[model samples]
Target: MMKVPKGKTVLVKGVASIKGECEVLGARLNFFECEKFVPVFCIEDCEIEINGEFRILDGSTIPESWKKLAKMDWETVFLYGGVDSGKSTLAAYLANKVGGAYVLDLDIGQADIANPGAMGYGFAKDVVSLSKVSMINGFFVGSITPQGREAKCLQGVARLWKELRRLDGRKIVDTTGWVKGRGAKEYKLAKLEIIEPDLIASFEGKPFDWKTFEVEKGYVIRRDKIDRAKARFESYQKFLRGARILELERDRINLKPDLFRGKDVTQFIESVLGV
Candidate 1:
């Protein structure tokens, strides 16, 4: 419980002891711990050493670059990076900075603008959680994964890219950390071809055939850190907490039409409930 005066930078070692916005002079962080539901780090021995006049700690590897990019007429901006590379944070930051832009999150697995198993497009009006705006247009992939579902995932991106064309602003496509091997490269190439963004930003790994900008750092947001699984579990439960329940008549919707073909599986429902 110490005051980090303005203009005085603070040093943090991935601890919860420090709070308030200060330029990250340096930080070593990890997304998740090996344990199932453990905290990301132990902050008991952490310390924040301040120096000089307090200043807004918003400096990043691409602050000026983002400013310049935001001023440009690039209608569609694409971001590619590895895991925990701050892709979502950058998209949200740039969407707010650029103004009048919609962030179309294509990271179905680690989705920001939507739940874990869906693609979503929404505007980043404020610094709120991206999930708050996840309801704009959610395309489900039926699984909390994107490894073998590249087709559906890319289709989601391409479909939403078309939907973005209906809007009157820029589009920021935040991608996943699927830039590992040959198949992934090909899949990403397909995504690039579908979106055909005017500008590409890469925080890590190389993406081909575009007017690309390389951002070395800004790989993680400095505000909050948590365990990945814990965060997902919380989000999953939060999503279903107040979910709407629907009741339909038995004849109103077919319960697996194929499964009941040439048979009367519904006989059980009829015999038991006599619906």
Candidate 2:
């Protein structure tokens, strides 16, 4: 793998890395070409500025265009996996790092995050995990199109996702099962739900659409779900896998705290024009 340069756009095939003076214009190759590749990664529409301003495209925490994500009032990161795929464990890891975030165990069917006996204080934030009984006849009207079922689940999910989206602090939402059949289908729906969220992730071996996720978002979807979930006794005992939990712990620690920490008491007091 060659390192890609900063200004010029070049395309390479196979397992090659780009380094120095270029952007990835395009390339064809085996392996998952589009798995985590986004349209922005395609440099076809770009032109080098005179005086050759350099831009680092590979593995950027926040892309130049997406730096505004840093300004969001709340950064939402969602997690999904099969039953016992360690969704909660990973959630705790993120919550702990964020210094008082909220966690929504949206696994209404099987609420593991709602463990009543003893909760892990390693999580740094205030946590709220809910368990709602399934309403009779609540499934999507037709088992037909993913969109139709999506429409049904959307309202059900929106009820929580919206409220979850709005809290004053950082957020981590652990989504329900890949209860659906297809990985591609599950991936599509998850992406739609977290339109503005800073990160959307799932565990490994869970049939998530990593291909589409990357195409939609520029950065690679991290997969630490397996190890994180395995650390928890829950998912490991079940012999389950293929969830798509993101965050490498490195990124979790490296994230800008100011973006996640919410407004200070003084800032709030100032908002009211107080002395």
Candidate 3:
């Protein structure tokens, strides 16, 4: 049985590019200009209240223990970095700092939490239940398969954003760095525009030359090598027009497993989160 959120109207952002409906609940959804959907359901039979005032729940800080901090104004934060740039470390650290902010593991293709064949459920799982967290592990889409998994993953992310907006805490989105930091595909790019968090914090040691790429049907396409080399001022004009950008500098770390051997991830967490 599908659960329809009750009362106060579930406000969805952006509009869907395609026409669709909630298969289980049978709610009609409309596609808006930006290709997003705002689906609202009337859950008259359920006891769950859809009011805006709900508390976040992650074990780092209980909702009851910190009413003042928990009730503070919430902001959605995004942690993005190339492979091995410590995006997850930063996300966990920040989530811990804010007490009970939600942490979504958006690295679905290369997931580390809340996926099959992993060890015990980790902090990521608890974060989803008690906070505004959604889809902590990357979606299950095999690169070699002929399936439509990538498209589904994109929809999943959009749905997650809609759900997160309903909760009362901050949102921390963890992104994947597929193919050397480029996003996975066109679908991922579409979802990015829809989620549109308050902050997009990029962690990279090397100075980012935004003009080195061009947007071709949503994906960032590399420019001609020689042309890029000689350019004095490159234009990341397309991305700049779409959203604000924030870059963070940290000691460069590679995604290679061996280099990070025996490192205490918790210590990294403390460095970012601070006690």
Leading candidate by lDDT: 1
Candidate 1 vs candidate 3: the lDDT winner is 1
Candidate 3's C-alpha runs over 4 A off are 1-74, 116-149, 179-188, 205-275
Per-residue lDDT over 1-275 for candidate 2, one digit per residue giving the tens place of the 0 to 100 score? 32333433332222233222222212121121221122113223333222212333443322332233223344776554554554544454345435556665544333443322111111233222122111111222222223334433344444455555555777666655554567545444554444345555544433443321111122333346564343344522332355566756675575555665654644543333323
State, as a TM-score between 0 and 1, how close model 3 is to the true structure: 0.38
Higher-scoring candidate on lDDT, 2 or 3: 3
Whose TM-score is higher: candidate 1's or candidate 2's? 1
Best by TM-score: 1
TM-score of each: 0.68, 0.35, 0.38
Clashing pairs counted in every model: 9, 32, 12
Using lDDT, rank the candidates from best to worst: 1, 3, 2
User: Cα RMSD (Å) per model?
Assistant: 11.7, 19.4, 20.6
Worst 10 residues of 3 by lDDT: 211-220
Query: What lDDT score is found at residue 250 in candidate 1?
Result: 80
Q: Which 10 successive residues of model 1 have the least lDDT summed?
A: 32-41
Q: Candidate 1: lDDT of 109?
A: 67
Q: Which lDDT value does model 2 have at 7? A: 37
Quote the lDDT for 101 in model 2. Answer: 62
**Residue 246 local lDDT, model 1:** 92
